[model samples]
Target: MSVLTPGDWGIEALWSALQPVWPGLSVELVDEIGSTNVELTDRLRRLAVVHAGGQVPDDAVLPVLLVARRQTSGRGRLGRPWLADPDSALTASLCLPIDRADWSGLSLAVGVALANALDATGQHLGLKWPNDLCLRDASQPLGRKAGGVLIEAVNVGHRRIAVIGFGLNVRHQTVPDRPTGALTEIWPEATPPATLARVMPALLQALQRFDQQGFAPFLPAYAPLDLLSGLPVATTDAQCPAGIARGVDTDGALRVQQGERMHRIVSGEVSVRAHATELPPAPGH
Candidate 1:
């Protein structure tokens, strides 16, 4: 596969690309999202107003953008290391204003939003837990993970912005494995920037949809894409290690039946199955 001559993840580039699209979007350079949020929170403590929409108020929440060349230390749920080569991944943080009252695991809804955007790229994508978008192998019956989405909250004074990030493996499939390449074991082209570019519009649209209805609006679309639903599987959380996936809870948590008890799995290190096989495992493996 052909990899692009790696573009620098500079603040200027991010600002340049976003300024034309987001009206008043601004850019900030940082080593990592964690540090970026820290700095944002510090600035917010002083009470700064971000002018957005209409009628400028005391609370002006601007989107402090962070694009890393390569995150020396990146994190996912339960602090999993989100290590991806600088060029192989897309790591971006956009500070967006959100309501505090509805901050109960709202990331799942974002996953659904991202999934809807991925669907427009001509690839069948689905949502998987707290934050992940997976591409399914339709012929294999059960689908698998293809990419990931991560969201963080940065509360500064009266402004609370969600620091949303997406780590998408556009070209390289292994480690995260590409569904098409794994099935075919051969690539069709050098690289796919056109496909990757589709993410920008997807993200913008998803965020807008998320604030309106949370996951309730996307449940019908998200259900069929549920990979482990109705299947004997392992929960990402070891607390309920042995159980079958019952699907997601109303709040977007994974539901698994452990013996006679049904428990909602908020987190777990998931794996479809680790072995040498081209086909999905049997129903009750």
Candidate 2:
């Protein structure tokens, strides 16, 4: 693995681009960490303790952008391990105070914004329901996991702070059963720093919009990029065993058609798998 300094990431330029969307936002890059999400969440938890003393510092509530060049114990949805080689993936977390009453669809909004920012035309990138980012190509129409989002929040005093973490394969791999996609496939020259610069601004803006208007505005934008739409899916929830995905509702809950009943599967309720009756073909099979 090669070493990368803060200069390589252009912290100053990234901070400038993100400052307009989130004032007082700070950016920091580290050589290695356990997990960006865990780090940010822990920071807010510690800050919450300070708030109880009624002597919280001004910077305590300010937003921060933390990037890790390599993650030793990265995590995904359902506590799945997210493994990435040093300099082989882009892993970052953004922590900021959120004042929204209803936090539903926040992950979907982030997915839509990232998909648009990376591929505005929706040529090769697609979103899988709540939080997974997949690749769409002729070789694999069902799409493969390229990245994902994890949102966690903590209450500090009277304010709520959200830690939004994401990780994307840069020059990764495709195993026999678990296929993966990389940023290089879409952008031949993609690197961690470059990729972060491309998506951060749009992500920050989308978060702001979600905080104000909620997820209703992102419904239209999420339609075409939805990977589970019109596909037979199986879920872990006993209530909705199998159904054809009808896409997500206004609140970001997944709508599945089960017989004559349309069941709504909220995030964190169950894990979904595409093609319940048939498995997707492995790459080069």
Candidate 3:
């Protein structure tokens, strides 16, 4: 499919795709197929902040969610673009009224809820810190990065609005040059978009709840899905390219035990470079 700009949002196609799946849910989708999820949300937030108390601009759509059928350049955290194919994923965003709240935390909460949704569908999904979903193949438990979440902050006066982006793999496919996987590979018969619709309500509800109670309420919710909690790992800043991830801190930074000191990395990509089968020979070797 060719890329679509926000101007090309054909409501009927967007509506047809989701109406059957997300019935009764208030989802206003735009047809911005070429937009990266992160950029799209940031644009929405900026518009809300810029035009506060004024009528919505002609080119602006506010307080509504955006879903792309063919997101040509959707991106994830650490500046990774989703290798989005029209039928393989759900590239979407949600808008919210942001105030003094660190509502960005909801991204993590949504990830956890999504894990629960996958579990409900008989899929065992694990969670990588910050907000990536993984699936472990018990026989070969080393897993794959299946999905990711992106959150951008938009200011509305003293208020901080947000546009949250999510990209999930629903088919048994992989992006040619990225470390991403899809649930359909694990569940051959599952409907990716339908699964998204089934799983999104809980995620939205959890986000709403967190907006009210803060991320504290979601700790228990996210704990079970923690994929590398105690596993020795290294975290790397996609930009700086160097980090050692020991574990997560109470505030969510990736902790790295380097000799006598431990470094907590709040932002970066953590890849499972060394799995069970690839252990070093011995201390002397």
Q: How high is each candidate's TM-score? A: 0.67, 0.91, 0.72
Per-model lDDT: 0.55, 0.84, 0.62
* lDDT by residue (tens digit), candidate 2, 1-285: 566677888989988888777889999988889999999888888878877857666566888999998888889888988766766888999998778989999999999998898888998899987899988856665577889999998988777888999998887754457888888898888888998999999999899999999999999999999887877777766888777778888999998777667888885433355336533432222
Candidate 2 TM-score, true structure as reference = 0.91
| Model 1: per-residue Cα lDDT over 1-285, one tens digit each | 333443433335545665655556676444334433334445554544443333435336665555553455566666665654545555555677765456544676666655665465425665566576666666653555555666666555555668776555544545534352221212223122333344555565555666665656666666776766756665557687656667776667777766667788766654444332232432343
Compute the lDDT of residue 198 as modeled in candidate 3. Answer: 59
Per-residue lDDT tens digits of candidate 3, residues 1-285?
Answer: 344444444444545454443343345554446654565565766666678787654334445566766688767787777756666676777766544355535667777777887776434787788888877656433367778888887654445566778878876565565455677776675553465555666766666677777666667666667776555555565432333344454445555544445566666566654543232322222
Which residue pairs does candidate 2 place in steric collision?
none
**Alpha-carbon shift of residue 239 in model 2 (angstroms):** 1.5
Colliding residue pairs in candidate 1: 49-60, 50-60, 50-61, 173-177, 236-268, 237-268
Candidate 1 off by > 4 Å: 1-23, 27-59, 121-124, 137-144, 173-196, 236-241, 259-261, 267-285
Q: Provide the lowest-lDDT 10-residue window in model 1.
A: 181-190
Which candidate order results from sorting by lDDT in descending order?
2, 3, 1
Better of 1 and 2 by lDDT: 2
Q: How many backbone clashes does candidate 2 have?
A: 0
In order of TM-score, best first, we have 2, 3, 1
Q: For residue 76, what is the lDDT in candidate 2?
A: 86
